[model samples]
Target: MGLQNTKAPRAKRANIVMLGLDFAGKSTLLYQLRCKDVFLTVPTIGFNVDMIEMERDFTLTFWDVGGQEKMRQVWSNFLEDADGLLYVVDSSDKRRLEEARKEFELILKNESIKNVPVVVLANKQDLPGALNAEEITRRFKMKKYCSDRTWYVQPCCGITGEGLRVALERVATFARQYSRSKETFRNLKEMDTL
Candidate 1:
């Protein structure tokens, strides 16, 4: 019986929630991460989940929450325990600039996600009217909310994976750091009794 029980069970996964407005290229980005070509693009009716296994025995489970107006109400449930967030924006859509700002503020103000680290993907950089990273930073008013944690505002063309690597790398690093900090705090608390 002891010899038969040598194999260990799989480790639990880490959760990462990514949110964005409709047409923000969230699904396209996910496909790019998976190294696949776009065949047919469709709006997500609800949230989608994708799991990625990283080096060092870490698995990242991504919750891609839909951004439709009607679906916004259900987003908080998924954001509640998110270890990190990725906010995707359509850099070429100038008309929605104000709306994007409002959405950004809403995410930051939500009690359930206030402290989560964020990585903003300024997507559509390959388009004609695409805004640069600095422009996105100014329009979103990110400085006000970026002080407490590590935040990355990167310009990306999700269809071609132009800046996707940088954004994903940042997310992984922040998530690992957050995990380490939690473990350290737990160890310190345990040592206090000794």
Candidate 2:
């Protein structure tokens, strides 16, 4: 005898993919969003996934891309379908600043990912020698990108969860706006066909 289906269908959810360099505390930030303590974290070999329930209406799928030189080759595949981007940087690591700038430019140049809303997490603000939000903005020359879309250089302590909620909220808001604009464009195209 066949069994009867009784389970109710679930609501559709949205995904917000975040990509950033290695050791940028992406994983730590994800852990903090889940309200977890971070004693030790192993380097993410390929990519890490975290699901955060924002509300009854949405869910965020955070993809933390590995930052090592060898691992960066696979990041483009993930970037293609992302609705939003979060570029995380280690504010206290001065040596990687140039590398971060190069990567930022690369992302900006990519046609597929260029227009996506981005939130730059200037992480490790609790550490010594960490750059403040203004210094980060100045050094990275991020102000130019701000005009094209919603961009924020948030000073964050990933391990402690400080400023993480604000970062996520910004991403969520941007994602919503992007979705609406895309839908509007689609409708306009359909109307033109009539």
Candidate 3:
């Protein structure tokens, strides 16, 4: 049901990694998308990988890694070949907004992931005290971290799948744009011969 895209005749593929604190709903969201149902998800010990077809001829491959402090040390290892990022945050946990901010900054610092587009999912929105877009943006100071690539903050609930589909669509749009730019650059370089 995941990856093993051998049967697909022709399709563009993009790999995206999901990163966030433990219980931020990363695993749950992945399950909802792939299986169309939710389950009692345990803390992702290491990582989980799944591939799903997105808008037309595009396959989105997701790598969801554990969010524990120890796991973060190895997060950079999976950044290789990644085309985009899904950054989940427990918006309801106001007490740890600063902590999430710090972790996010660290992710931004990683040179490998710096250039990739990012979609920040402010998860657990169904809970009380969930930070809204304004609060989240301020806490994460997202604009400060953003660069040439596209970035956005979306409030969502992983359990009920609210805002999940729209988020994916936006990310897929960014991925498609990136693909076009890369192809254009290659073509331009090929035509540069004297």
Candidate 4:
């Protein structure tokens, strides 16, 4: 008998939208994931996209959107199709945490992204006086805003690459679970209407 060649199936893909205020290190984090090295990045005026192969046979496609005040109005436009979300925060900027929370609350109101998995990266954790993940979570009122979604708060240093992989691994797990549950719900709904 001839041997049959077999190949592993392609990894499932997840679209993850990354957003935060300008200077939150969103662009730096993206490049860090892509190259596993620190990268100097300018403020993104529009958007940047990159794909990272993650654990659990899943590939994460990240959409790093611009976060200037003028660009906040268009954030909802990218939420409709996102499988997951990464909301970066400048943990050292304690004075502006409230502003960040307001923006996060607004984004969570979009119905299209309801129940999407989210990872809040409290970046700049290595800096002196930076808030830890738990503090950031409380400050953001994560339980209040993310009550209907799967969410996590991770303390990380974008430049040092601390906690990045662990955070994304959690994201992959949640994304896969959420995707399956959503599919099952759709199937059940369709069957009911039949």
Candidate with maximal lDDT: 4
Per-prediction TM-score to the true structure, in the order listed: 0.88, 0.88, 0.89, 0.91
Better of 2 and 3 by TM-score: 3
Could you give the candidate ranking by lDDT, starting with the highest? 4, 3, 1, 2
Q: What would the per-residue lDDT of candidate 3 be over residues 22-51, giving only the tens digit for each residue?
A: 878899988987887888999999999999
Off by over 4 Å in 4: 1-10
| lDDT string, candidate 2, 132-183, tens digits | 9999899888877556777778889988878888988898888777767777
Please tell me which predicted candidate would have the highest TM-score against the true structure: 4
Scored by lDDT, model 4 comes in at 0.91
lDDT of 4 at 48: 98
Show where candidate 2 strays beyond 4 Å.
Answer: 1-12
Model 4 TM-score (2 dp): 0.91
Better of 1 and 2 by lDDT: 1
* Tens-digit lDDT track of model 1 for 125-172: 999989999999988878887777778899998888898878888888
- Locate the minimum summed-lDDT window of 10 residues in model 3: 1-10
Q: Local distance difference test, per candidate?
A: 0.82, 0.79, 0.86, 0.91
